[model samples]
Target chain A: MMLKSKVSIVKGLSYQGGLPMLSWVLHRISGIGIILFVGMHVAASFFVHVVGTDSNIPDLLNVFYESWGFQLFIYFCAIFHALNGLRIIVLDLWPQALQYQREMTWLEWLIFIPIYGMGVFFILRNAFAGG
Target chain B: MSARSTLRPRSVQPAWSFEYIMWFFTRVSGLTMYLLALSGVVGAFILGARTQVDLQTLLRWMFFPNRFHVEPYLDDAAFWVTAWWQIMQILIVFFAVSHGFNGLRVVIEDYVGRSFWRPLLRSVVFLLWLAMLVIAVFVILQA
Candidate 1:
């Protein structure tokens, strides 16, 4: 009897699960990621300002962009944060669509994987090849 | 740990105090980005007022990269130049995520009388930004 009911719960459209909460938590977590990357970018600019452009500042900045590891890290960060950003922006603007939130969250994640993978390929071709 | 200057109990930490410790990098990073943007704005204002475009000034402002408006408080140049960028990079990621998504999370938590569809829809938008932030950062860093 218990097993039969458990299967029905998942099969039913009304079923509640851990995903809503998980999606909520992760979405917020990614916002910080975007801010962090921007922060580093800002700090680097400051240094360039102080020293002037005659120095190795541009070269060093290029070095980071050229790095394969850094390239992948930044690319994924952009993809996840941007996709998730779209979802949260919609959620905040409209508060009545709670029902679709679960389904939308899953769709966003699915879309994110392929989008981010494509991003990785592009960065590797443009930035990593030189390094 | 010094006593917090607040009405809370000795055991109770102020909101900024605890969040500062755990999310130190992101907070600092946000500050950095804010300063950077401020600098750009200021530089642009100065340039906009100029009669003839100054080549030297333009290049300085353009390629100067991050606006170091906050660096005045940082005192440590070496740290800011190298280690700090990476630190800010990691932390900014965290803080932006937290601040941006807080709205959606709150709405979901308070979904009693609230028009549920709008906030949920907005949440989708925020999540997309989050995905872009993630995918872009990782791809850039890893590539």
Candidate 2:
């Protein structure tokens, strides 16, 4: 574990800039995002017991997807969270990639762009179609 | 520690109070988010189960508030149930954003002297959270 502890990321890269920092921060962030999302899912499940088959269910669902504001937020969150998670996993496995870190970092953005587009498409589809 | 990490008052003069407060807040928030996520998954299962069963036979006179005559969507049960879950899942988004923000903050600060470089990312995180929170509040109120 000591070797793991000594595993520093700065060794791979020669320069300091915002891009690498963003990825590093995002890697941690996406992890935390997933954790929190899972937690809220559990808590909200409890409400189902009380309001099981409640009439408000449809309206609530409609309200959520009916609006553009929530939809856009969700799309962005999903895209960034997922893309950043992948970046972290890759970095952890290949420390030497720091040498070509910029290329890899841009790759993350490349993947994210499409994912964001997909999210927007679905969110808009659901939002406009229903309400 | 770089000026970026050191820029925070805590790095300059560490104290039990600030650390303890931050620790407590994070754990409490983390646990809440964890449980919330769990419940949602379970809720999905529960709703799924209802779909397979004969809700018409079982739910008759059950006194559920949302009960009605029309088939809400995929049968009377599924549409209602899935929608209900979706409404609640918004909170999960909030928790997720918070958790992600906290983790990002640490990672950005981990670099030896990169505090100066982190402000922009931190600002982005804060703004996203604020916007998400505002939307969540509005949606929940509308619900």
Candidate 3:
């Protein structure tokens, strides 16, 4: 005998899924972070254009933007999102690739680490050297 | 047995629907922005961004290509102020703003579920997208 139930299962965020789950969560977070940064950037540029760059807001924004901390975070979000996005697209185009998801993620990091490391180096140098 | 015969046909969505169109746009626009950004970076390096500009200025130029952004750091920014760069900036603004807002809409749809807030939030995102495009274009052209 089969019985029908009205309740629905909600299988939300659980850490047990490991890397795939972490990647999915980070993708969404990075996306939102990029959008927020873009909004502020566009607004700052618009304000500077309208106010002739002498305004305090753009100056303050530049100071905040120039910080190594913010720079590293934004760069990480951007590069990670882009690389992970490419991986997702590849998987979509070739469903068979899903079987190798773990390997693909490792490849993504293999590419991501050196690129992000170089960016970090330049940013730190610029911050310390006052360039 | 051939692979085509062995596998079941996949279900397809109607291409004319809003969701379907947006899903396609997301992929296309993401690739388009990459192309545009690549061009910007290469063009900046060619235009002396490597030696003349600092890392920060080079980054700003790579992302936006606005003449004013780089002019402060360069001896001659005439190449950046040209119509070609303006066109690139405009294209970037259009694609990036549209892609970003659509992503936001997807996020809203995912979380808000079946509710009045879904449509309302979508409308808000749409209006913001429109406003962003307008302001961005205005600034680009005015520069």
- DockQ leader: 3
Stretches of candidate 1 off by over 4 Å are: A1-22, A53-62, A126-128, B1-143
TM-score of each model, in listed order = 0.39, 0.40, 0.87
lDDT of 1 by residue, A4-43 (tens): 2334534765555566666655555554554445445544
Cα lDDT tens digits for candidate 2, A47-125:
3433454545545554554368755654455557555555555554555554566887888898888877876776577
| lDDT, residue A63, candidate 3 | 78
Report the number of the highest-TM-score candidate. Answer: 3
- Candidate 1 has an lDDT of 0.50
- Scanning candidate 3 chain B in windows of ten residues, the lowest lDDT window is B1-10
User: Arrange candidates by TM-score, highest first: which order?
Assistant: 3, 2, 1
Q: Per-residue lDDT tens digits of candidate 1, residues B5-118?
A: 332335545477643543454334445545543454465454351433333333233323222422343334233244333444444444454444443344444333345665
The lowest-lDDT stretch of 10 consecutive residues in candidate 2 chain B is B60-69
Better of 2 and 3 by TM-score: 3
Provide DockQ values for all models, in the order shown. Answer: 0.03, 0.10, 0.35
Worst 10-residue lDDT window for candidate 2 chain A reads A38-47
Best of the two (1, 2) by DockQ: 2
Residue B127's lDDT within candidate 1 is 81
Best by lDDT: 3
Which CAPRI tier for candidate 2?
incorrect
TM-score between predicted and true chain B, model 3: 0.87
